[model samples]
Structures are given as C-alpha cells and as structure tokens.
Target: MDHQLTQNLEEYSASSTTIKFDRPIPLLRAPSRPGLPMTLTGPYILAFKDLPSWAAAYKSCESKIIAQCEEGARIGCAITASNKCKPPWWQSLTGWKSMDLKERERCEDREMEDCLVSAKEKCMGFAKEHATTPFLDARIALGEGR
Candidate 1:
C-alpha cells in the first residue's frame, strides 16, 4: 500500500457528507463485488454528538451561525450531487446561515434521515460534478467536527 497515497487520498474529504468512488482508478478503486455497493453505502452513521444535550448542541451550532452572520460568511448546505468531484466521504459543518437554532436542529435531523434513505438520490445533484462509483461506507462520527 502506498502510505503517502493513502494519506493523500484519505485527506481528500468531501463536503455534504457522502463517500463515493471515481470510476475505480487503480489507486482509488473501491471494493469490487456484487454486494459491494450496498456494503459501501454502509451503516455509516451521520452522528451529531458532543455539545451535551440537544439544547447545548443547538446553541453551539447556533453560535457558529451567528458568528458567520456577523462575519458575513456564506451559508452553504449541499449534498454530493452538487459538488464537482466524486462525492466525498465527508462534509464540513456548513450551511448554518439560512437557519435558526431550531431550524438547524430540524435540518440536521432531516439530513440524517435522508442519509438513511436515498443518500445517492438526495446527493445526486452534486454527484454529477464528482463522478464516482460505490466504494467505502461513510459514517459521520460527530463531536469531531465541532
């Protein structure tokens, strides 16, 4: 295994919290098997942890939104379909400006739910820009992003 290659590739995370493959390039190819795609989609959970209670998490996330607003930061929330690369396996904390604390919480929950259902479909728009095949599964281990 190319340690450097793995490191470089692993470092290449995508925003919108999805992980996909780019046409099975030799270095980036995902596992090849019949049920591989399903396995790749994974039980990777989109976790939102830390910040203690929901209220606290809400507040922390809200603070980010407020800070962004004050700084005139752009709020961006997108699925993989809209992105230009093969959908990434991760997403940064984004798109907080257009929502209030409650809205953020709701959106978070909704996105999590969406991840459970048709993740590829939900993120299809961004996927076009980032053409890819099914590879590794993505689990959003929260608490780390904050």
Candidate 2:
C-alpha cells in the first residue's frame, strides 16, 4: 500500500534529562533515523537487535517523557489548577503569556539544549555500545516511475 502523512512537531522544556555532543554524530550507518519506519509506503524494516534497544530506550525514557508532557499540559491549562492538566501537546496549553513569541522560543531552545547535554553523552554511549549492530535501511521511490 502506498501512502504518506505529515510528521507532527511539538516543542517544550523541563529538567533531569540531557544529551550533548562535542562533534558531529553520524547516523550510525543506519539507513534512516533511529526508531523511525523506513518510508511512507511499504517496505518497513525492523531488526531483532534494534527492537530490544528501542524498547529499552523508550522504557528508560518513558517516565521522563510523560512527566514533561504533563508539565507542558499544565502550563497550557486554563484553570488555576492547570497544574492538574495532562499536558500541552495532548490537551494544548491555553494560558496567555506576556513574553514575545520569538523570545519564548529561544528560551525553550536554550533550555532544551541545556537539558540534552547529558542526553547527548548517553546517546553516544548507546551508539558506541551498539556500534557493531547493523541497522537495515529501507527506502524506495514510487509514484509515476523511476
């Protein structure tokens, strides 16, 4: 089956997580980005080794992800109990802020970078640990012809 869809993007910030790099990080010889399906159409590739590591990564980061999402949601909440909301991306943050949009974005980006410094190190550690494991590439051209 041939198909395609736009990738949804979101933004936010929090604490207790960091990933950084002093030099460029290669794609680890993977055909595509890690944990992402090869294409919009068919030809999905999943390696046995990757499955465990993928699950482990998510498991390791799941709580952190949820906590941050909840915090975002709370910030977006309408009530004074916004702290009671689920998360902004999930439910959307509706509160009004007095700061400039560009400045807010810059702040988010800076905070994100700060938190990811350690995360970058962690990813490098994983990539080094799995340096030997192969990541299969699956990409194809479609539509009219080649």
Candidate 3:
C-alpha cells in the first residue's frame, strides 16, 4: 500500500485521545481586515534546551495559558466560521478530504492569538492596578509583553 494510504489507515485506527500535542492549539479567528489572520494551530514544541528561561517561565504559567488557549480556540473557531475568514497558510494544512479544514484552522489560530493578546493585556492591567497580584508580571516573564 502507498505510504499516504498506510498512514491514513494507521491514523484511523489510532486513539485520537492518545495523540496529544505539547501545546493544545487554540482556534484562530477570522480577520476583520478582509484577509487571513496571522498565526497557525499546530503542535508548538518548545525545546527546553533552546530557551530554558522562556521554557521555565511558560512552565510556571502552563496551566493558565493552556486553559486560556483552549477557551480562545473555541471562540475563535466560531467567530472565524461566521466571518468566513481564514488564517495564514503557514499554520495547519488540511487534507483534501476535509475541504473546510483550512478555513477552520485559520479561524482557530486567529481566535487563539486574540485570546493570548487579551490575556496579556488583562494581566498587565491587573499588575498595574494591584501592584501585588503579579498575574501580569508572570505573563510578561513568559515573554508576553506588557
């Protein structure tokens, strides 16, 4: 059998739950600017050795970030579909069998970005307002600019 066919067969038999990514991708939202949103939804791997400091920072906030990313993906997917917007091509590529995969992924990525940006802003604002919470500080430490 051809490799693609074999891979497809393997995929079908595989447990979907077992195929987890290091990062649970957020859905991208459609662009209001009449084009694709910037960002893609895929398994984003962070090599601890490459950027240990950033990795540590992200680790500290992993739970929060993951939760937010998931929420963002949900919102983004819905909005993107409604707006009929797509995300950048560099993100995830859908198979030919799934005609809407491209657009859906695009939308999801956009939503995810939006959620991240919003979370960053909120954290920054709380940091400024409370001066003690450090919620924003934590996010900033993870490379989310204030």
- For model 1, how does the per-residue alpha-carbon lDDT over 1-146 read when each residue is reduced to its tens digit? 89999778766656434767668533212233334344534433222322243334444445554444433312232342223222233433453333355655666556545443454343433333232222112222345555
Q: Give candidate 1's error at residue 53 in angstroms.
A: 2.7
lDDT of 3: 0.48
Give the candidates in order of lDDT, highest first.
Answer: 3, 2, 1
Where is model 1 more than 4 Å wrong at Cα? 1-43, 46-52, 73-146
Best by lDDT: 3
Instruction: Assess each prediction's global lDDT (C-alpha) against the native.
Output: 0.39, 0.42, 0.48
Error of 2 at 146 (Å): 33
lDDT of 1 at 72: 32
Deviation from native of the Cα of residue 118 in model 1, angstroms: 36
TM-score of 2: 0.24
TM-score of each: 0.18, 0.24, 0.25
Candidate 2: give its CA RMSD in angstroms.
Answer: 23.6
